[model samples]
Target: MSDELTAKLDRIPDPKTGKGLQAAGRLDGVAVRNGVATIVLKVEPDEAIDRLKADIESAAREVDEVDRVQIITTLQRPAGGGRDKAAPRQASAAAPRPARQIIAVAAGKGGVGKSTVAANLAAALAKAGQRVAVLDADIHGPSIPRLFGLRDIKGLRKTDTGIEPADAHGVRVVSMGFLTKPGQPVVWRGPMIQGAIQQFLNETYWGDPDVLIIDMPPGTGDAQLAIAQTVSIDGAVIACTPQDLALDDARKAIAMFEKTHTPILGLIENMSVFLCPHCGEPSEIFGHGGTRAEAEAIGVPFLGEIPLTIELRERSDTGRPVAFDDGPVADAFARAAMAMLDSAREARKPAPEIVFSS
Candidate 1:
């Protein structure tokens, strides 16, 4: 049955490439179950998404066994290879948002719990009565959707104002994860990444939140450059583990923000230690105080340290941030959030003018 549907879909033309859907590689997958057909389509941004979806749905319904048709659309990587010469966009071209403060949470490399920190921080802020929005700009490795328990969201609604963000626990959420399937890889180029960031900032109606936390992708790469140059970032909070290798990358992240002139609010040391739940023994698994030491060396405030524990991981996996409830981890994140707010606002203050004696 699925094969028959695929053959039918193959006859439909893809608007972007001017070829049959299958020939253009637009038909990603087709499955039939319980008299319902599920079709996955890879789409380009400028293509007519609705028209293509309608065409495919109409064709799928013609099959005798298919009682309903559901189309899942995922973004395709932009065209162009190594020869492309376009430079990164300037800050003047960026679309502005109404959020009072924009904070970027970054990690020098992957596996550093950057997304976890960002989500918990947003939750903590929201719990404190501040309107918060989180833009999961991780692109290729967007985990904000899952951390917030919104993994099932496949798309967003477009109104006269802009794209509507998904709300979870009082925080407005926007992420590339919502558009793509679970475990699906985003193979976009650098230019595509920058463009997506612009769209998220410009097209999403963030509703004048008090704080906008951008969950930055691991490493100082295209996404980082895009956010730095595309918007007036109030400050950046760096997340890193307590290890030599992680610290090496953390330094690079700090340098990137410095070069971009984005204020470094502070450094957060995640996974500082592991406390045995049963025995209550503390273990410095990654070696402790590395991030604080680095923060002191760089003249930036050390926000706080997050201890590694089974509860923290369990809460993150189950779509409940530990910070939402009252616990030791929650307390630590709350403190970090308070420090970040203070540091960011202070950094935003204008330099005092010096008057020399005439």
Candidate 2:
């Protein structure tokens, strides 16, 4: 089925080279599942992206088994070796920085609840009267849309200006989840991931916000490198558990940011304790203070600790983050949000340069 879909895409002509999309290297990926055909295309700035998308969608729908066609586009690098230079495409062509502070919420490994931390932080920032936007960079596991209770949003609004993100809880969000259907997996390579990040940064119409919280995919791999190299990330907030295993990965995350020259905003100790709802007593389920101690050892600021409460879990599951409501968990997240803002401001300060006689 996938091969048939690819064949259909190959027949679509690319106006630039007057060749097929596959021959021109424009068809990035093709997949067929449950009668739905998904096509990912690499489009250049000068190309008629909408026209090409429409053409592909129309062509794919001709297949008897394909009941629906979904098309996704990524920013294609200019021909003749332009990947390195492509990082600044958005900064040079797009309006300007989408927000004053572009902070990446990252973790060294998966299952660390990084997306939950990012969602609450964005909510807390918005609650504090700052305009916030979230970019879910975890293309394979995009949870921001569900975290914000935006699963109903099927697609983004594409205008002559750019793609408009979905709004929720007074915060704007952009995620790969919004493009693909539920339960659909994103099977892409490094270059494809890089292109998607570039497109989200450059082509999205994110009205000037105070902060853009990027929920990065776990690990120090291609996605992380793509984000670090593509734009001037003001700072990165590392999320880790209280266990030694999680801390080990967190250290690697910090090291990656340092190596990339992106500032370490701070570290967050998530699931620090479990507060029993019935007894109102605190239990160090994951063992407490490990992250704080690790932060002290590494000389990085320890933002704060987020407790594991029944309420916190319920709110997150229901798409209503605890950060918006007044509670202990909300207070903790607020404190972290403020600390992140401070770190971002400090990061923006220009380093003092010394001049010497030569």
Candidate 3:
């Protein structure tokens, strides 16, 4: 039995480093008694706790002889000593959320490249060496799976902690597309939609990303309200074409976020202009700078603009986001993404400490 437990521990991999648990020295102490396995882990507070828990549970399941698994994690201070016993209780109560920041990319109406912007922004952030995740909360029109070429991916695996998210384009992705079949229309009512959004927040395994970009459904409806209540949204990025009609809806979107007390990070003026690929001439096909003017009028930062290029549409349709390839469109997305990050930084407050005691 002891040998079996050792074998199981040997097979367990460190979720952060992807090395075997024994190789990473994460499996410090192990004791098996009567088919129950007990393990002790010494980890840093910055380590991915959700991943660690999942790895241990997965290893335990692989060992048929093990009926149950117990894991205990202890945090060590930077001074090579354990945490002080007298640490303030308030410190624990003020624990920060998993991700340092969460930005929602939303639009007043569809066809404004909201999801495209969200996906590309997440990809560009990852390219800039920031850990990022994209949550496709557009239940009725989830395009994230297709954008990242994860349409055929399997459902997320459940561990002791929560459901694990899929990885693509160096960014973690969770989408309602993964939950329902292809081409199936989701006709869920308000309560059900709200419940699903809540599950995405509380149940999905997001690990410890630096930022999370939520692709909210287009509108200022019940879905938007549910997201506001479910997640601690650090800020919102409203996307709109430079058209009067779009700007009108965009203002409503911004107002909705403001009413919920979520900071408006900035506004993205998508489709601000269209450039002829061959002629190199720019044209305001939808009437330009309306979103920017609206942002300024409403007291929010104007992030940047993206042109309506043929390549942008083709790339999106092919499941190859423009951000993944180098070109004018890629550069545009990178700039827009950086601007959003800067706005988020300006809007953020210091994170509070979290304390966990056994």
Candidate 4:
């Protein structure tokens, strides 16, 4: 069993360095019992984990004697680096609301239009006959309410089992702003911030929806950590622009998610281009396709680019997301959403045959 499994594991290659697993000492463990093979791999964090796992399993199963194979993969983290352990993760919601998927939209820093992208993405998904819910996890600076032009909304309401979420433009909305006074600042400690996020996630009464989009706050902070331990996140979408400053932060955001072991759906290049109204000429305002290039470098898909336009801002500010109307900006968001849908489905694909059903 050992010799056969070793031969099989050594035949595979590392996705990043193009070196065989045996050469890199990545195939750390292999055992076979009762026709089942268990293999362990210690690879770099940036390596294509899903592809590598599938490849390793396929090779092991080809051994003829092995009936089933299980691959356990762990990232090779740098020395002195460990995962953030600030917040205590809550158990899965006891109620088990029927949300098919939850995708967190995050950025390295603020002002990257992360919230706007999440809002418009949810709007686009809803327009495509998907029941969508948008949770403004940006507790400190919640723009989800303002993005949908719900300026007058004071807060959410208490309910018998859970808190009720607001409905805006046919999308479910929930934010910390609903509980605080207008313009009031949320200057709390780490525990307070985590508590707020916990309530929003576990206590909200979100009906069955096809997708639940979380508009995460900028930077990797307590909120991000809280979400990591709270529930099982389906995937993440990193939002960034073409500017170097923004990309620098975007890299940090990506690293944080990697450390947390969350699958990244892809990166969205917001403000990819700017259109001049008078001359109808396009300008590389933020630099063209920087996010696409970054995505390729990081091995994630370049979902789509959203050109900078005033109509998007105006409609978003007026409680009408551009995705609600048919146009260029709306089409861009729809394309981006479609990319996510595809990536998510592929990522969540079930193994060839399941021994147990959930």
Candidate 5:
């Protein structure tokens, strides 16, 4: 009976990785007595136990000779527990918490490719094997769904615990665009917008993702205030063109985050210059270095600059992100993502240790 139980345990697979549960070290003790089998297991602290329990039960039942199967689980230090110990405990406080990092991509005004940057950065992180999700909080014009080729997808539905997000390009996506019909304008008042934003954060089931990118609306408004009050935002990335007009609004956006106590991760200068595809020449179409100067003046990091390119506009118009293709633009966004991660790491506050006596 022990032999049969062992074989059955070998067949079960880990829910996250889809490998054998035994191979993943999910199963531990295996004992059998009088045609009954009992198994002990360890579970991931961040994962739901219902699924793990079901997997163990189904695997034990596979043994034809076993009359009954019993399972028990206790939280154990994961394999190579040193790494888990090194991670910030504040970042891992509880289950169903906000993402490990919440990055708000905001702009002083619209049309600076803020949404485009948010979508591409999320995709680039996903491509780099990081679990990512994008939340389009630009209630007036949610463009992330369109950017990820998910314009036709419907809004997420409420599950037993929370809302289940739609999947796109291996990244979970939730947006106001998914909720409203295409071409329909969101003409709701500030209170309505605030309610919607609150629902998206509180009701949505954003699984345990490494990063959650929020595409905020153009200006600092009541909707943005609602988001600030709702989530524990890790940091923010302000987007602006190099033009003076946009920089004026960009400063306000930065101030808003600072006033709300959200760390300013960095500033991204989009459309700083126009790069010619044929000649490989750069033109200062929107002027130059204004955003860098602003970053220096404000004492915030300047993440990077993105050149205005035809491919960027065309790809966004066609519902495919430029980051999906290999080029200078993709490289720029990749670097920006790394910079954001670095900034978040630097800003992380150590978790308070809990001491207990035996």
Candidate 6:
């Protein structure tokens, strides 16, 4: 059966070298099983590598027994490549500092407390003595400035190297809200949005930090794809409420990540329950436990849950995330942040500097 799969691969030619992937020594290995195959391609990262991957997957699916295919891109270290002896990078005479792991806090829609989660997560990580930075990728509606209490401060400024992000509560932040007046909306096309996201990543003067959290825009849209293409994301945390609508959309979002081959760190159930102010009893205002069940169904970890309460809302509105105040909300965010750290660590891999975009 393995020989049959190899024969199928032999029929498909590599776009660059114009030889079979296996024969050309680019096919690292293949794992074929009951209707699922993971094709690992080992080659020098390049522009057309995405197309090559697609071609390889197409050939693998030709086997009548295979139903789904996954591809893991890996480093093809050149001859004599190692920490002690490596080739010079083309971008600079001196080697650039190694980048820290970047995690994107994403959601299926707006109003899911995504910004609040993102802001509090950054604060919690920072409080734990880790340097952190956040990029508000929600271009259409930037909320980091207000959440971090930097709305009054100047937005991004041009530095000699690139642009400078705002500082708040021990975390560096960059957002379109800082660029424009409060309540102003960003009206732009897809390409413009893509460019803005790229600039935030490649052009920001982000000194080496412990963790970089990107508050991805609501829903699976251009910003998500832009991030996937811009950098090698270490992991993504999908935020969702306990409502049925949110769970349905979250499933779709999970499918999107799966299709793109991005690792899902875990699922966070935000606003899991509403604490009654008077009776102090937990109420299922927006339903309850749906997100945890969804996470289990999808085979991802159920990171943690945050209850809906007035204190959490008030702190976020005042640009003082409960994470700084150290309350119930703070505890919730801290727990989720630590889980995210664990997930990122588990999913860590050696990625190349150049991304292969289609």
Better of 2 and 4 by TM-score: 2
| Residue 281 C-alpha lDDT in model 5 | 95
lDDT of each: 0.86, 0.86, 0.78, 0.82, 0.80, 0.78
TM-scores, all models, native as reference: 0.76, 0.88, 0.70, 0.73, 0.70, 0.70
- What would the per-residue lDDT of candidate 1 be over residues 216-306, giving only the tens digit for each residue? 9998788887776567889999999999999999999988888887889999999988989999788999999999999999899999999
Task: State the lDDT of candidate 6 residue by residue for 1-358, as single tens digits.
Answer: 5567778887778776778878876665565665656566665644457677777788888888888775544445576755321111232223232248788888888889888888988999998899999999999998988899888865568788777888898888888787665675665555446556766777788888888999989887767776665676777899999999998888887877775667899999999998877787998889899999999998898889998998888888889778877667788888999998998877775675997899
Clashing residue pair totals per candidate (backbone < 3 A): 0, 0, 0, 3, 0, 0
Error of 2 at 125 (Å): 0.9
lDDT by residue (tens digit), candidate 5, 24-94: 77765676655555676666565687866786778777777666665545345566656422122232344
Superposing all C-alpha atoms, what RMSD in Å does each candidate have to the true structure? Answer: 6.5, 2.9, 14.0, 19.5, 16.6, 16.1
Question: Residue pairs in steric clash, candidate 2?
Answer: none
List candidate 3 segments past 4 Å from native: 1-96, 349-358
> Quick one: RMSD of model 4?
19.5
Pairs of colliding residues, candidate 5: none
lDDT of 4 by residue, 1-358 (tens): 7687787777777665677787767865676756766676775634567777888888888877788775544335456756547433444455374377989999999988999999999999999999999989998898988888777887577779677889987898889877666787765556556656766877788887899999999999888987886677888999999998999999999988887778899999999898776676889988887899899998998889998888887887788889889988999999999999898888788879757867
Error of 6 at 18 (Å): 35
What lDDT score goes with residue 120 in model 3? 86
lDDT of 2 by residue, 268-293 (tens): 99999999999979999889999999
- Whole-model lDDT for model 1 versus the true structure? 0.86
Among all windows of ten consecutive residues in candidate 5, which has the lowest summed lDDT? 83-92
Per-residue lDDT over 283-304 for candidate 3, one digit per residue giving the tens place of the 0 to 100 score: 9999998988888888889888
